[model samples]
Target chain A: MVTVTKPLSSTDSPYQSRGLLSTLRRSPLTLLTHLSVIVIVVMWTLPTAGLLISSLRDKEQLAVSGWWTSLSPSTQRLMVRSVPPDAQLEEGGRYVLRGKVSDDQALQVLAFGWSSREPAAYAVGDVAQMRKGQTLSISSNGEYELSSPEPFSGARGKRLFYTAKIPPRFGLDNYREVLTTGGIGQSFINSLTVTIPATVIPILIAAFAAYALSWMAMPGRGLLIALIVGLLVVPLQMSLIPLLRMYNQIGSTFGVDAKSYLGIWLAHTGFGLPLAIYLLRNYIANLPKEIIESARVDGANDFEIFTRIILPLSFPALASFAIFQFLWVWNDLLVATVFLGTGEQQMVLTARLREMLGSYGGNWEVLTASAFVSMAVPLLVFFSLQRYLVRGLLSGSVK
Target chain B: MTHLLSSLVIMLLGVAACGFYFVFSNWLLLRIFPVRRVSLQQQAVNIQRAALIRPWLFLAPALGFLGLYLVYPVVESVRLSLFDRGGDAFVGVANYRWLFASEEFQESLLNNLLWLLVVPACSTFLGLVIAAMTDKVRWGNIAKSLVFMPMAISFIGASIIWKFIYEYRGEGSEQIGLLNAVVEYLGGTAQPWITLHFWNNLFLMVILVWIQTGFAMVILSAALRGIPEETVEAAVLDGANGVQIFFKIMIPQIWSTIAVVWTTITITVLKVFDIVLAMTNGQWKTQVLANMMYDWMFRGGGDFGRGAAIAVIIMVAVIPVMIWNIRQANAQMEGR
Candidate 1:
């Protein structure tokens, strides 16, 4: 038994180690988890990818094929027919000539064969021998000549082999098209017009409300907060028609039209206010009670406390909510559509994305590339301002 | 001279009264802040009247704005619910009577009930699972952020994203939607997913769930992290295994937080319109109350009474959940 005991050594540790990819492969569960991450990323990004690949290919190819097909080598068959017998070439006792259908258009020939059915199994300079001392030699580009003791009845053509160059992946063309011809550029501008004021007006109103709600000892202050909190759950859907009618009524009264940018902006501001105030108030109320107390002790007014102390500390919340409201308003379509118009002057980017999807359903390239173009700003904003969304942004604002 | 002077004085007084609202609300905000003013401190023996009038002053503009927009709509919805399409005749409870009487409204009501039940519950459950699973991983933040990224997208964008996933093409045509492509790949005939009635409603609900799960996960993940170490340790000392500890200690402690999350998502689920609109246009029995109300009032040639009736019903359904949520939120705030 003692003799059968195995020796232990540092090099013989039971753990498997693959160095670089060790974490990736260790446990079956980890592998699955890693795979899940890959899957989720793929799941999230695949449609976008399909949209992109579809956009770049020719419309017929997109319609007939899957984007995944583009990953594999594409093949095509053509009947050369000796380039018409009158044009057959003669060179150095042999007929030879070469020209492409187009000037270096990406694809190059692969293996080619002579049989009509076996299109890619033969090559250039192959001779087709016939009876009575007859022969026909064909070049890669359907150039051929026949020298025979007996006349040839049919023109000869040879299949060829040359690897085609698929062009480099500079996929910016779809993006360019989306920007220029897709009307997304104008929609981009429209979205900005709707979003900027929609964002600013809320912050402006909410900041003031937040200050009052957080600090003011008004009558029914608790009740007011309660009512606002109660209002938070009121579905905006409930108000859509009434708001529109009200807008129509007010507009008619003021001689303003039914659907102006002003109407949409005000509508968005009203919609965004509850959440804005709630978020801002939560952050503001959490501020160090001492700070506001000290500010009050220092003889500053509530407005001054808001401007000087509370606002500075609440920057992260403001930024986070701003990103929220901005992204919300920027990506809004329904309000803009019902309140605005389909006219080029009023269409938002989201409305434009919808139109593209509606009209060009099979046009994957336009949709994906255009959608990504629309997402560009929001993604930038989220990534840039996300650092401010740290865990402690609300800490020390109040205790 | 007397008549002209009296008229000018009344006009001036009216203008002053109008101007005072802004000053008043501002003063009210000032008074609540409780900051010590040097001017006031110097005259501490004589408390200025400005301090007494502030909150009323500060609250006026906000209240006015709230009254004009937020409060007005809510009241008008309840009032409008009782009237006819034209809002000309007053008929008490007739709209409610019709809402309960109509099968279309009933169907919408049922869909909304399903939406309220399924969207939040599924989203929150999935979110909890994701947050729980991802929390143990090294790249949890990245995972959470990637998931939460959908929450950042507007309902419209998310709806469009899912539309591509649920997109349908006819027989022999190539499937553009990822889901349909998978079906074709698996040798199964492609399905028009959004036309599948009950399941299609779920399919539409999925977009809302997808967007919201991230929100639930982030908030719940934070709540999970906020849980006290000692409580967990004590439960561990009592020999609670991981599952027991999670169920007994962690979940119970985080119950309020979970409630807050659940209620927030529930409220969002109640208001969900964009996803349903973007995906199916509320066709094929996928209409929820909000979208149905929208269609009735705004799109289907404008039936204000029915729309407002639906709106009130939605509000009635949501208020209890909203109250519970605010209570929990305030409790958590006070607890902190």
Candidate 2:
């Protein structure tokens, strides 16, 4: 029988190395590593998780409580007004005012008090002394009863305070409100509108350019490739002032609107081309020389070889670049803010979210929901095509 | 609804137009050259001529966009920096003079320096440590994914997420923010985290670190895995401890990769705008160069000269990295 042995690399499973596994098992370091990793993972994910949880919580509850307390019932101090003298009824020779402290049937009142200074002074079912000859008591089920020996006489009802344990409530109300009233729905559409064309156009343009740079034996290919690598790091800030000026000049000469979807699309395509071309060229050049040579031998022109063979084979690279460009254009605030107008019609999700942050800074309910609305598409893309994203990152930066 | 429909139409038209350009141009080139049917010598000449012209056809649209958008803007920005706010009169370094003298500019510069120093280092270090640690664990992929999730979020989205964590309530009220709630639980007082001078800059940096550490981790993890096992086995045979192996053997091998991650994050740090703009809008000493440049662009009917000068400053800062990148790429190509 023939025996085969494979060489082990650093990527090999530790379990495959019996000595390493035994040592790892013998030491406490493994435990520490696992524990610390768990901690780091929690620290990294908690903020986004909190935002997600908060966006689903009741807006009123979201305002008063932290998101950590979202899964369990939260204790909240609340107040209710008793019935006035006109609504009082004679019960067993006493005037009584009876009502539920809250409309929520599920609320469990833990304590009750007449004064805000000590909102939880008395336990549930305890009768407390009142200013007049009145006595008050609250049940755990948010029921309250007030009675007076002689008769209740007042224009307004007396204020009673209680602390209630509210059951955790989760819903899509925040998303609904933001989408309908907060204008995030429009901005979501705007983001998609900006992203799809920006991504597709650049991929097509860069793919052609990359094919030429890779296989076409063109003059200046080296210089062009170097130029692209240099352009990869050019700050987008450098492009803004001049482009704005050019667009304005063009707008005046042609009497067209300065900020249009066409202008932003073109702008995105330009800014995105360098990285797109660089990544695609890196991928395409490394494709097997034999495939292209054989195709050429079979009398296939460069265009047919590219369209039929190289393009299909380059799907992984294309998908990765597509994801990168999509996330970039979708989540972009600076480019969108600069190239596009900030009107209600033109505002993308990031821009709208920023405006909301300024206008509704305190409204966490709105802000969290809108932020998630802006985040949802990218998060979906990230989770679904993460493999391609990582591969792209590896190829793009790690030579 | 109408807005969406119109945008959809435009998107379709734009994509169709790009597709048509490539196909039509290629067909036209082939038709003009007519390499398939002609005299032998003529056909050979036509093939060579078409080979020369076809690549340009493939390259023209991309080059046009790059030139018009990136290259032209660079030169125009420098020229605009020399001109007045209206971009008509040549003022000759007046914007640079004003930039140096301005207190806000100095403040922004200092804050940017602090951000540049802290964010990249923290993120890279944390990422390296996490990557090393996670490699040994069984659930490492899951852990890495959770840590890397923040990268998917926009800077604005991350700002909001962290802002919620750093939220503050008055002294007597129940603290809704996690940081303050923790503080109160730990017998300390809740304070506004983002408004505190000097420290608030650190607070903003934390958000970026949180977002970028994942990027650093993913890249460095791959680098770590690429290390040959024989070297690690040798280290183990030599009785080197885990820390010694990590620092002495493993780290040295991945230094270039670490540099790559660090420089990438540094470039990102230099251009960070959305977080600051969303969190504090450069209030409370959190101003950065990108945000400041954006501010000057439209602060009061816009000061184009100052804005473009600030952009030039950013461009100057990036040039070294740019040159380094080109050198690295060229070296890699030559090695290949």
Candidate 3:
């Protein structure tokens, strides 16, 4: 049998001892590996990064430009109506019309013109000769002046067009809007409601079951374990229809709503149990048998030993399962859509995000913010408890 | 706000009730056959009997949920599949016949097959390559974390992210989507990606691949690290190049793990619904079995028979994998 050992580090490899020439020869391959890994990391990370960046961008810029371009000042062609002719005053014997082209102080004008046909006909601060001996000039800071040798005659303000560089704007407006008017805040609470009980209940139930399956000398234990392993892959599709019918039947019989929090929570627990039992059993079984035997010898009952001994000892496994259940329930759409009500009050984050995807299909500002809001909790749980999460996955599958 | 508060209270009550059952049942069991009150000879027998009943008490709630949520529905779904749309009448094999003959079912089946073929293979391959590559680098952990990050985001959210990338615009306009922007930059026209027939299926598959590759990498990386150092030392001493060592030595050693990752992804691929639903809702022939099953469940008020039929089809596809898992588990238990 091959024995597991510390993975061989590149520096310790025999070939590295052959001297600088061989190391030099391998440098390009090392460089290629690093380059490819960076490319892969960027490719993997860019989409979510885009979502996050887009969510914080000013809604108008988010609509007009890509998130990657959000770091740079983008050029925009804008038209603003100058104050009506009544507001023009005589200055140095010239009836002048003066106004800032835009309220945004960050906007820097690159060019300006009076007519649409030549929107950027003149450079910043260059005087453009207009009709009737009127002269128009725009400064880089979006101030424009139209001076006429004669009095300005138009009753309506002249429509002046200018090309300006809009500085990149970022804010929390999208998140604010989505959380309030877009109904994501309600859904966030709903997700927590569904996830917490659904996550906690199964761990309690599955821990006892896993303990029983592991240590107890019971008949059909092997068969029971195998059944659970088989149940692990049973497509949740099979459960949706019959369970829906059952829930409706029971609801009608009891004069209660067919779709309710209790129902979905129960559904999540049931669906999550097989894996929970399987994972916890793998852990609980491997625990040294001595502790439990010693506890029993001290006259402790099975429940006492379990509560005092197994539960505390299995903290890592419990944590692993908790993270798994939390992520799964929080990220679940198919189960939530089927089992929970879709009212504003009952809609979970994933389901709400789906509805937003349909209703706010083209509104990237809304979509990006809502997606990130929904992703926030799971991502936080993932990054912080990532060690336990990875431990759970490795134990769940690899062993 | 009141509704959320009430639900929180109810959830705490439920947790308390679960705790009470365990404590109460165990307490009652000991009270019924009081070890201190009985004769010493009878006490030994009582303890033996209580032990026999104790496992059942521990197993009760889990078994109830498994039966109600998983096992019963499976059997009932098959029964429902044999009935009419409302499940009011017995219509043996009729829904099955309809399932076999329907054009939509054929489309979904074809799409599911393509998904089954593509998603698992791509995810596992990319994961294995990333796993192998990351192991040699100093900043591997951080790179691995970024790749694994998508595994946290919901499929619906990922679809939105990808949708933004695949966003399109009319010609002579600025393309805001990354894909279209890149395409436009390369002097190629941007096409609406998810509406293209047949090819759209591949586009949807890419999302699942992106999410699942991280999972495959995590599992396979552990397997790669588990390879005995002597094997690689022998390979290196034999003058094998990096690629040869990877394929010939590293992969063969981790073959079982690769199978585990591949099959796990295959199961995930079969259940993929939210991506299709949020992306195209199975438009443009991107229909898949899971999404089709969800559609039939509620389409036209409801069709329980047809919905269950589709679910059964998905279940049937999973049975082989189920059997393999059971056998592997049984073998492990026996070895223990």
Candidate 4:
């Protein structure tokens, strides 16, 4: 027998020399791995963090800049009404219109400019004086001046610069508004109605198809499988018009109509079937034949073989596909729009999210919270059934 | 009467199995493939026999549904594909020619090609790497789950999430996207990442890749586990280090599993429509086949025939991949 020879001559046993913690600490890959873990966790959480914060803060703060800039107060230059345009007061030599505008603190005004595009470069408490055809003069608190042969509005309108202190405040108002005002709560229920049935029916129907296709001795099985696989690429868009026609015909036959939850659900199930059957068939077919044969020998018929033996063994695959189907159906907007409602009762979470994006997209807090709310169920489902996802459901079953 | 009861029981059992094929295949091929009628006549098979009635009993419901839902619509879609939206007149493949001549449709096809070539390749590669890296670690499963989390998210959800990441604001306004927030913090202006045309399409691709990477990892991880540990130890004994063992031995062994994982994701990437639809609305030159089909069929020209033509194109594109998948699956089945 040719035996392999060892290498690494004259090396001390590193495991013996170093403790596990010490070795782990020194291992660069492990260190890098941990660092990446932290980086990723933070990256995933931070936007949500900022979004939550921005939502809690005053809406004005959200508009002026990013939530991060909320760390310091934001400044704006405004021409505050000095005694309004109509208010007149006589003091000493003539009439002096007086109202104080001041911005000072850690958030003290730096500079004010004539336009919002150039809000800075002229400091706070600066006064520009002008009279047309005479001389226009402008002076800052720093005694900087601009003078021309012509007078200004002496009044291009007085530009006032003052930084306002904004304190961080937290509230559940965004969630509340999204829930109550945005009709998201109703959409959430609608989405669940669509998603749950769509997911369950396909899986239930496909499970049987898969078992018969994979295990049951049946003629034309290969052709059926091929046909289903071919249908996998048939875009749902192609069938919408035809399906609606069928739905209309069927509905009228049964006193039903063009748009309803049933239409959306059935549409989704049909759309979801090709992949579900393909996936479930692949998984069930790959399950150990001997176990199934053993069950058969034990006097369990096909139905009993499926329920007791295959169901438990196939949980991981079923769960994985369930997650897939659930997510797809939950987030579908097109089918719902076509077959279901434009009404409040008919909108799904995705459609609601679209509306929110169009109208309140600039509101960081509302958008973030609403987005996360839309994301919440999927995240929950993903995390819960995630273990089954890693299992090789097809392993030890196929070639 | 007893024979009727027994055949009725067989029909009921057939219905329960949900495989109408067992009963109907014998009947369906009678005219289409046309088996020997003379032998059948000699054998005295009767079309009016209760046996024939029994088969139809089991087959009727499934066949009816299939015909109404699947087969009939397919036929209608084909016919619709050859006509205008109203089904008013024969367009005679005009939509197909128009689509073929249109630069926009051509661009969409190219984008689909990019998706086919790029998303699966990059996703599988990243997934494979991540799987291999984290396979042995104590926290590997956790890491895998975190990465795979995107997979469970609806494409729209992922789009929403990544949209926030790619959120753009005009110059002088704070970028609301998470990516822009970081870039701005690091003293860079917020760039319109997703609207950057081709690069933006790649940005959309990242979401698919993110979703699929976990799938790749999970499958590839199983393949990695199936790598015989003894073989690995033996390689080590031959003075092979981690890199050499992985390249020379481990890779060669797990090549088939890699192919399976790669092709599965490739098929999925071909069907990716929702992500692009949700994210950019296929604007700024990011249209793909499915989205184009929707726009043409539903919104713009209402050209059903062209829509079917594109759907057919996708199906044709997928045929080779399906064959490869089946062959590999068959091999793997026999291996077991």
Give the alpha-carbon lDDT of every model: 0.67, 0.89, 0.89, 0.63
Docking class of 2: medium
Provide the DockQ value for model 2.
Answer: 0.61
Candidate 4 lDDT, B13-85, residue by residue in tens = 4334444443344455343434355567633454324233433333343334455566667677767767866
Off by over 4 Å in 2: A1-11, A16-24, A83-86, A90-95, A147-156
Off by over 4 Å in 1: A1-62, A68-70, A74-104, A108-170, A389-399, B1-48, B91-94, B172-174, B237-239, B329-336
lDDT of 2 at A207: 90
Candidate 1 chain A minimal-lDDT segment of 10 residues:
A1-10
lDDT of 1 by residue, A327-371 (tens): 878877767877887888778888887777668765656776777
Q: TM-score of predicted model 1?
A: 0.78
DockQ for the candidates, in order: 0.20, 0.61, 0.61, 0.17
Model 2, position A146, has a per-residue lDDT of: 89
| Model 3 residue A125 CA deviation in Å | 3.9
Interface RMSD of each: 12.4, 3.0, 3.1, 10.6
Q: Candidate 3: count the clashes.
A: 0
For all predicted structures, in order, the TM-scores are 0.78, 0.95, 0.93, 0.75
lDDT of 1 by residue, B1-336 (tens): 232344345434534544454556555544554335646664553234455555455555556656766778888888888888877688888888888898877788889889888987888887776766566556556766677666556666666666767777798766757788888889999898989989998888877877777777766776676678789889889899867887888888877667767787887778777777767777898877877887878655787888898888888888888777567556555686
The TM-score, computed over Cα atoms with residue i paired to residue i, of candidate 3 is 0.93
Each prediction's Cα RMSD? 10.9, 3.4, 3.3, 10.3
Model 3, A1-399: lDDT tens digits are 111112323453334455545543678886677789999999999999999999999988888888899999988888889889999999999999998998998989999888999898999978999988999999999888989988877789998999889999999999999888988999999999899888988998999999999999889899999899988989999999988988999999999999999899899999999999988998898888888899889999999989999899888888989999999999999989888899988999999888888787889999999999999999999999988888788878824
